[model samples]
Target: MSPVDSNALNELYKAHLAEQQRRTEHALQRGGFDALLIASGIEKFAFLDDRPYVFQPNPHFKLWVPLIRHPDSWLVIRPGHKPRLVYVQPEDYWHVPPEAPSGFWVDHFELIVVRKPEEALPYLQVPGTLAIVGEADAALGDIVPNNPPEVLNPLHYARAAKTGYELLRLREASALGATAHLASQRAFGEGRSESAIHNAYLDACGFAERDLPYGNIVALNEHAAVLHYQYQDQQAPAQSLSLLVDAGAHSCGYASDITRTTGNGDASFQALIDAMEAAQLRLVDRVRAGVDYRDIHLASHRETAGVLRQLGIVKMDEEAMLAQGVTSTFLPHGIGHLLGLQVHDIGGFMAGEDGGTIAKPDGHPYLRLTRVLQPGMVVTIEPGLYFIPMLLDKLRATPAAANVDWALVKHLSAFGGVRIEDDVACRETGAPENLTRDAFAALI
Candidate 1:
């Protein structure tokens, strides 16, 4: 990434850091509490709003966590004349300075540091329902009603609720992810291996001025069904086949996840994929506040399965098909998760004061949602259909598999999977807007 890419984020982070203070002060007044505490790490909290504040051997350690005791803190600027910041120093970096640009938390907030904070910080000695955040869990202490949720842990809670500035940054990031995907998709059609396409994604990140987030999954045909399969140096097919690539980029400290599936295949397989894309369109265009996300997920699966069964891939009862948990034979993971500071970010599962909920499916132990949808939450609804041996075995062993069309399954077995994911902003008034879908389509 160029210096310009790094500088823009630095400016964005400063503005966000200022907002953290405003939110903290509001929390203190309303909760009748003393302030908040945050525990950070060098490798754990790797967020860069615009640029790195302190360059570390490990690049992901930079972050700004807030300590707020009340909800109103987000709206008020502390009653005290100025805000306070406890700047901890890693034992090794105790002598070096903050390592960030000038004027970072120097005037408005007090900066203090402690070594081995969990074992030695004087503030943790403060006796109140301390609402700890970030790495503050057991180190700062636990939360209790008598002690109360004074300190919010996982600072990601507030992060899940994007700021106007953050939304703008995310928009740009989404666009970049689309651009990268398209480049890699083109490489796929040209007979590039899955690894070749994967490299294209990294190159896109560099050119787009972003640090490549996580390694991407570029699966073609049977390889796509492996889900999360990383094809680092494998050969790619040259024939009409299905290509499933799940990739994204980390820009301005937020993550953008967008998946696209293209095919050089028979009419039947292509039609099946068209059905998957249609399901994505149906859900992406209507996700707003009050949406029971489970309904959306269920609908996507139901629709995908309906298409497969209609296409003669499955010879089972419609209701029983989904009930048997057969979708795993195709799409193995949750549609998607909350995307932000940490990729999966945080929140969306807990019952927040905001009353939003994203439910987790009992059958799919990994399904992360656990509450009803609410405004201010951003999530991905990536639904997929694949044909994997392990999952197929599990499903076929069940009584519900009796009617599945074995012949059709054989045909789709080589087709792999179809996944379409887009980042969506949940809103109060209308449908949630898709941030990555159009970009993905443009590439195809």
Candidate 2:
């Protein structure tokens, strides 16, 4: 069972509401609005007469209420006042009407249920005075005026720093996801096919495909070299060399992303995996409040180069290899990214609390995070080393090619790659807490 206490869920809910109110009030003042209306969003439909896609409550709306139902529910917020929920309960046999949630958060909001979403407009502030968020099409026509980026950007920026409640959900997510990783890892060792391993992971976590934070990446052997290896080959190789599983789980509305690599009795390949894991941990230790995330990413490259030298994969010193961009050939991706409601959470590159953005450094377009580390922020520290044939072929044609041992690369490439990812939480002091580590420890 998850370590998250049931009573704590209520406490988390209360804390979440406080944060939402704080963000909403600040946004309202900055955007020059007397009130804010956040919609739960409407269901989307596919081509022609296709059944509507499963409803995903607007992140903004879910931040305020746990209700995930469709039918265009809404939230009304004003400074120093109790918020209101314009609940929608459709009266139809085609689908079951959503019952009002009964929880610690429900009492905080003055609930008003209506048969149609438009009926709740009378309970809101004047159209022009209220700023609307969520689905633009779900708006009650002129009953609620829309607030553009100017109003939304502030809230988006504030979400980067999580509250105590959000952290708890994140911890639960990490702990749960670690269990799934353990199951998948064992399946690989048992010579299970990639598809079978993927199924084992989901079954262990009790989550459906759509319920996942993102699609699972279950790759075996050479297939691991593909950055976003999407295929889950039905057949397992006669001799399994390695396995890479990048998967995650959700708790409440938060997410935990984790990746692990395992070897199949290949001494050299196992050594590389151990080296990558150790280097990843050392990099994770660098996560602390006030540290620049980009610096951590660069540090990872330098460290990865050192590992390559130790394994005789790179001919030059770590510094020389980094300077020659040889490290990029092995570890091509950004060290990691922010983790939260969205897997690649928003505001990663936001310039400030209100708006603007910071561009990724040149030649590092895949880097997803750019902000300086701060307390209450959670991010993934994933460092990878791969012997990709395409990248290796390109490097083979370059002058820096001499820095690599082609024979070793050819032998190691068959084992694919190694990636060690952990969700880390920044602290006001000391080393950033390793959620993945704690999650795994909890299992024992």
Candidate 3:
């Protein structure tokens, strides 16, 4: 692994600060606020216990400083002067408290340490003029006011187009994830249990489960039919047929959501995987500036129908299958979603910085991202097909039942599903860059 370029990171933060300040100033003008007061957020206890769950700092606070080392900190940003940071260093015996943060980024902020949350309140002037931008901090609630959507929408919208710095981290995160995916694929091909394959992924990525952006989905055979499959069987099935691994890795608070499917002993299943991969690549090529994402999503449904018809899995014409919703039973969910700091990052449907949102099409309600393609935006293109019993059963009762080849369905159902996903970044020109594929190539 190569070292992170600290100067580049500093430059990224500088660009991010400029963008944020622009959004904040616009929002403040629109919402009648003087300054923005942001809390890094505090830890929450797990159910019925004092133990804290994994802590995630507020995206607003982390935006300015990737303060992965500190929690319960606060940030105050105004039009002028250096940004102020209220660093927290707890004096506790049970666990090791964070040391005062020291990094290339530290010099950018005016830092102050407080043992408790209340001690930091005295630093703010005219708190009533400030609009809160993070987790609810009751200590400052009496003074600071809640941030209305007018103030938040623009900031959320600004994140959709990442800085050059964020793009670098995202590429690194995708590379890390692809490394783990290769290990998991090998483990699956070797007949290892789902639990073991998942462990191999973690070992390859060098991170704990809590550190993951989202829970890893390691599904084998029929288990792949479950969209959010969670359980990891302790023992491998006697007949290992298919593997569907949806996992990712985090790099400096950025994430890469990638999925890959592999098959065993069945040429037809391999063909299906190839078809999906080809279809996904074609769709990814369309992810450039000025393209409407919903149109791409609809295009995916059309291609899926074509693939199913080409394979004799569905008998109806492509238009008929799409019109009757027959295509959804086999390949449901959106073609892809925005990928960045969060797995399903925010601002996917927002129409503008003032906070207008667009609704998903009636037939395709599961789509997470509806924004048009733009330069610097990153997204995932995941297209899948499954032989799920429940969906198949429903299809069997519908008018579209005649479209499906029940015999072929029965024959291939045991092999589970096929999904091919890749993370791509929309460019200022030409086709989007496939970050996941580029990462996988590095392994060779």
- Better TM-score candidate (1, 3): 3
Which ranges in model 3 have alpha carbons more than 4 Å from their true place? 1-4, 126-128, 137-145
Q: What would the per-residue lDDT of candidate 1 be over residues 1-444, giving only the tens digit for each residue?
A: 112354555566567766666666555555666645443432323475544333211111123432211110111123443534445434455355333223422443554454444433454444544544433222433321132343242233455667654665566678788888888878877888877777787787565322555557788888878778865656656563777878877554567877888888588788887887787878786677887766676676677777767777877666877887766566677766777655676665766543345456666656666556777677888888888888888877887678788778878888876787889988778778677865555445
Cα deviation at 413, candidate 2, in Å, is 1.4
In model 1, the Cα lDDT at residue 134 comes to 35
Model 2 lDDT on a 0 to 1 scale:
0.86
What's the lDDT for all of these models?
0.62, 0.86, 0.86
Candidate 1 vs candidate 3: the lDDT winner is: 3
Over 56-138, each residue of candidate 2 has an lDDT whose tens digit, in order, gives 87787877776655558888888878888888887889878887567656787888888987787787654446777866777
Which ranges in model 2 have alpha carbons more than 4 Å from their true place? 1-8, 69-71, 91-100, 118-120, 124-128, 143-147
Choose the strongest candidate by TM-score: 3
Candidate 3 has an lDDT of 0.86
| RMSD after Cα superposition, model 3 | 1.7
Span of ten consecutive residues with least summed lDDT in model 1 = 67-76
Q: Using Cα atoms with residue i matched to residue i, what is each candidate's TM-score against the true structure?
A: 0.74, 0.94, 0.96
**Model 2 root-mean-square deviation:** 2.1
